[model samples]
Target: MKQWPFYCEQECEQYNVSSIYAPYLFDTSLLFFKAVSTALDLYGGNMSFYDIVTNGTLIAQCSVGELTGATDIKCCRHQMFVYNKTPVMGRTHDCYYNIGKKEMAYIRQLRMIDHENVNKLVGFCMDGPVLLSLWRYCSRGCLIEILTNDNLNINIDGFFIYSLIKDTVEGLYAIHRSPIEIHGNLSSKNCLVDERWQVKLSDYGFPFLKAYEQPKSSSEQLWTAPELLREPEAHPTKASDIYSLSIVMADLVNKNLSFENSDYNGGADEIIYLLKSKTSRLIRPVLEPVIEDFNIGFTHLIKDMWAEEPEQRPKIDVVRKIVKEMNVGKSKNLMDHMYSLLEDYAASLEQDIQGRTKELVEEKKKADILLSRLLPKAIAEKLKSGQQIQPEHFDLVTIFFSDVVSFTVLASKCSALQVINLMNGLYTIFDSVIDEHDVYKVETIGDAYLCVSGLPERNGNMHVKEIALMSLELLKKIPDFRIDHLPNEKIRIRIGMHTGSCVAGVVGLTMPRYCLFGDTVNTASRMESNGKPSHIHMSADANKLLTEKVGGFVTKSRGEVIIKGKGVMETYWLLGKQGEALLNVDE
Candidate 1:
C-alpha cells in the first residue's frame, strides 16, 4: 500500500499538516488496503496490482468494514457541541476574523443587554473551522411558527396577544438603551417564543458580520422601512426597527405570516415594488379586524410608530407608555392570566361531571328495562350476579300456550314484512292484557306465545285465576285486532292452559332462555291444537285449581278430546267470569 499525507494551507510552512492528521490518515490507508484484499479474494486472487487499482467498481463495492478503532469527527475546539432534535445549544459558525475593539465591544454590549425578552449570547468560538457565537436556544420555536401553526389549540384571546406584544416591546427597549442602539433585523421569524410563552428577540446586534452576509430577499424586505429600502446599504436605524416592529404587530394582530393577507395580492416582491414607488400610497399592513376589540387609540399608535418620516415616529419609551395604558386593567403577567384560566375550568368541573353521571344513570335504567323483558326479573338478576341456576321444580303452576289460528294461510297470502306487522299488532294487545295479571312471558315462537303464572315468582294457587282472567281479556281484544294487509278479514288465536309440576331453568349462553321441561308443557300445547278458534281451552288440573280452589270462573266440559301427545284427556272450555256475561266465543 502507498503512503499519503494530509495538511491544511495555514500550517503548510511549519509541517505537512499531515503530522497533525497522521493517526486518521493511517487508518484511511488501512481501510483502502482492506477493501483491495476483499476485491482480490472476491475474484479468486487472479488480478494484478495494476488491474486491482484500475477496477473502480470493485473497490467501490467492497467499502464495507467492521473496524474496532474509532474517533469522533469534530472541529479542533476543546468544547464538544452536542446536537439534539430540538437543540437547547447551537453555534453560529461565522464569528468575524478581525475581532478588534469594535467587535469585542459589540459582543460585550450583547452580553450585558440580556433581558428576559432578549436572547442571551453565552460566549464565542475561535479555534474551530469558522468562528461561532454560542446562544441560548429557545425550544418553543419562533413567533412565525406559533402564529402559522393551524393544529395548535392555544387559547389565544386578547390577553395572550397583549403579553406577546409587551415582551417584544420590552426586548426592543433593552436593545435601544444599549451601545448597539438598534435591532438591525426585527422580523417575526427572529422573535422566538420560550416554553412559557415568553417572546425572546434573537439574531440582534451583529452589524460587522452582517455586512459580509448574502443580500436580503424581497420577502424578507416586506418589513423594511421606505427610507432603508431606498438606501439599501445604509445602516439600520432605530426608526427602521420600529417600522419592522409594526409589521410583526400586524402578524400578531391578524395571526398570520408577515403581510400574508396583503391587499396587493401580487405577493412579497410586488408589495416591495409598490412601496418603493414615488406614489403617495402609504403601504402598511391592514389592522382592522383584530384592533376593533381593543381601544381605538391602539391602532393610531402603531401607525405613528411606522410613519413615512423617521423624525415623526415615537421613541421606544413613548411606545411603551401607550402599551401600558392599553393594558391597564388587564393581568400584570401571563402567569397570573394562566392561573385565572385554570380557575375558570375548575369552577365548572363539578357541574360537568354531575351532568355526565346523570346521563349514565338514565342509560343504565333503560338497559335494565330491556334486559328484564328478555328474561324473568329474578332470573336476570341471578345471571347478572354470575349465579349458577339449576333446574327448579314447581308443584302446581298454570302454563298458558297460545298461537294464531289459520296463521299459515294468512301469512302465505301476505308479504314477510306484513306478516311481522300482523304478529306484532296481535301480540301487543295480548301483552297489555298479560300485564294486568301476575305472570312472566316465556319465549314466543313464529305465531306461538308461551307464558306461565307461577315459577319464577310463584303466587300460590292464584296463578290459575290470574291466567284464566288474562286469557279471557286476550280473546276479547282479538275482535278489534285488524290485520293491515288483509283489512277486512279478522284475526283470531286459540289459548290453552294446564296446571301441573314442571322443571324450569336458563338454557344456553348466547340468547339464553328461561325454558320449561315437563309433560305439563306438552299437554297444554296439545290442548291448544284440539280447541276451536276464539276460545280458551283448559286441562283437568287447571280447571280444578280455578273452579274448586280459586272459584268465580265458569267452565264447560270439553269431554274426552283426543289429545295428540296424551291419549285422551277431558279438557274444559273457559267461558267467562261468574258475575260477567258469557263471551261470544266460537264453538
Candidate 2:
C-alpha cells in the first residue's frame, strides 16, 4: 500500500507525540508494548520497521490498546425496555479498533462535556453483537432532512438561512474551543437539528477507535478537505474542519445538497476523484445565481473558507466574528424570530376578528328591530335563547284596537295593490304616532291593528294613560293621512281600548303572533266595531282607569247601551285632551 488507509484517519492526534513513531496513538503506554510483542511473536520473522507500519490494519491492531471487562449485552423479550427511562439513541459501527484507556477516557470526557451545540454521549455497548454508542435522541433530523422534506411548511427566507448557518457555525466554534479541540466529523449529516432549528455536532474526534467504525460513503466524503483525501495517513486539522463547515454553508446558502450544481456530472465517486485530482480550475461548490443577492462580506468570507490551500482558510474564531457582524441587528435565537412572526400574525388576525365582530353587531341590531315588530322584545329574547315563554297575565293592562272605517267598501273600489298601498300608508302614519307612547304593537289583521301596554314589560298604572294617549294620537293622524292611489280621500280609523286583566304570549312556532286572550281584547274589538268613524271609543273599565286611577285625559259618556257579551255597559269617547274640546264623533 502506498499510504496507510484508515476510515477516520488521524482525526484525534496529540501534537507533542509526533517525535515518537507516527504508527500508533500510545507508544509510551504498557498496552502498546504488549501489542507489539504479540505482533512480533505472531510474525516469527525479521521484518523492516517501515514494512510493519506500511501493512496498515496489521500495525494498527498491534500498536493501539484496548480496555478489558466488556460485559455481554442482554435482551429480555418481555422486559426489553423497562429500565430505559433515560432518553437515548444507540448506533452500531464496524469492529476494528479496541477500547484502550485513552479511548475510555475519551468516552468519559465526551460524556462529561455539555454544550448547547453538542450532543452528549451517554454510554456504549462494546461487548454486544455490535458496537453500540448511545446519544440523546434529537427529534428533528439532520440539516439535509430539513432542507429536502417537502412537507416541512417552513418559509425559508434570509432570516431562516441566517439562523441555520449561525447555529452550525456556533456548534463548530464550541467544538473548536472544547477539550477535544477539533470536530473530526463535521458534515451536514453529523449536524443534528432540533425543533427550534438548533444544530448540534455529533460523532467527532477519537479518530483511532473511530477509524474503522464508520467507513466513509461517497456522499460523506463530499465535505472532506482535498488535502486529507490526497494524504492517506493525514490528520483532520482545524483547517479541514473549516473546509467541512464551508460545504455545509454552501448546502444552506444554495438550499440544496453539497456540490449539487457542481461541474462533476459523474456522481459522488467522480466528484471525490475530481476533488483529489488538482486541476488548473479549482473544484468547489459554486455560490452561483443568488450570490449577488447575498451580503458582499458573507459571499467573500465563504469563498475564503473553502480556499484550496488549508492555510488560506480563515480560523473558526474569525468566521464566527464575521457571521456575528452579518447578524448585527437580527435576533440570535430562531425561537425569538418565530415569536416575532407569531405576534405580527396575531395582530393582523385580531384586527380581522374585530372587523367581523362589528359587522355582527350591526346585523344583530337590524334583526332585533325586525323581531320587535313580530313579538315583544323580552319575549323575542326568550325565544332566541331557546326558552319557552309561558303565557303571562297582567293584572291591569290597557288593550287598544283600531280599524280603518268602511275599509271593505274602500278596498272594493280599488285593486289589491292599491288597497295594500292605502293600508300601508295609513298604518305608516299611525305607527309613527304610536312610537311616541310606551306600547307594544301586537299584530295587524287586515285593517284592524291591536296594540297593548304593561304585559311583556310592565309599567305601574301608566298603561291606561299610554293607551289613551296613543289612541287619541292615532285618531288625530287619520285626517292628514292620504292614500297614494286615491289622493282626494282622507283616511279615518275607529279606535277602541279597554283596561282589564288579560293574558299575553307567543301563540305559534311559524310566524309567531304575540296574541292577547280574554274578554278585555274581545270587548275592545267590539267597541271598535260598534264605534263611529274619526273617534276613539273606550270601554267602562278603560274610561274609569283613565278618569280615576291615572287621571290625565278628557272623556265623553256614550250612555248605557247593552253590550253583546256583557249587558248594559256604559262606554265613553276619548276626545282630544283635558285642555281641548271633545272630538264630535256623533256626526
* lDDT to native, each model: 0.79, 0.76
Which pairs clash (backbone N, Cα, C closer than 3 Å) in model 1? none
Q: Lowest summed-lDDT stretch of 10 residues in model 2?
A: 74-83
Q: How accurate locally is residue 315 in candidate 1, as Cα lDDT from 0 to 100?
A: 89
lDDT of 2 at 111: 78
* Residue 141 lDDT, candidate 2, scale 0-100: 65
| Model 2, span 457-535: residue lDDT tens | 8899999899888877666667777677677776777888888899887787978888889988888888888788887
> For model 1, how does the per-residue alpha-carbon lDDT over 16-127 read when each residue is reduced to its tens digit?
1123234455567677778878887887467787687668788878868665332222332112243443333344533346778877877888888768999887776566
Q: What is the lDDT of residue 155 in candidate 2?
A: 54
In order of appearance, the predictions have TM-scores of 0.65, 0.51
- By TM-score, who's the top model here? 1
Quote the lDDT for 399 in model 1.
Answer: 91
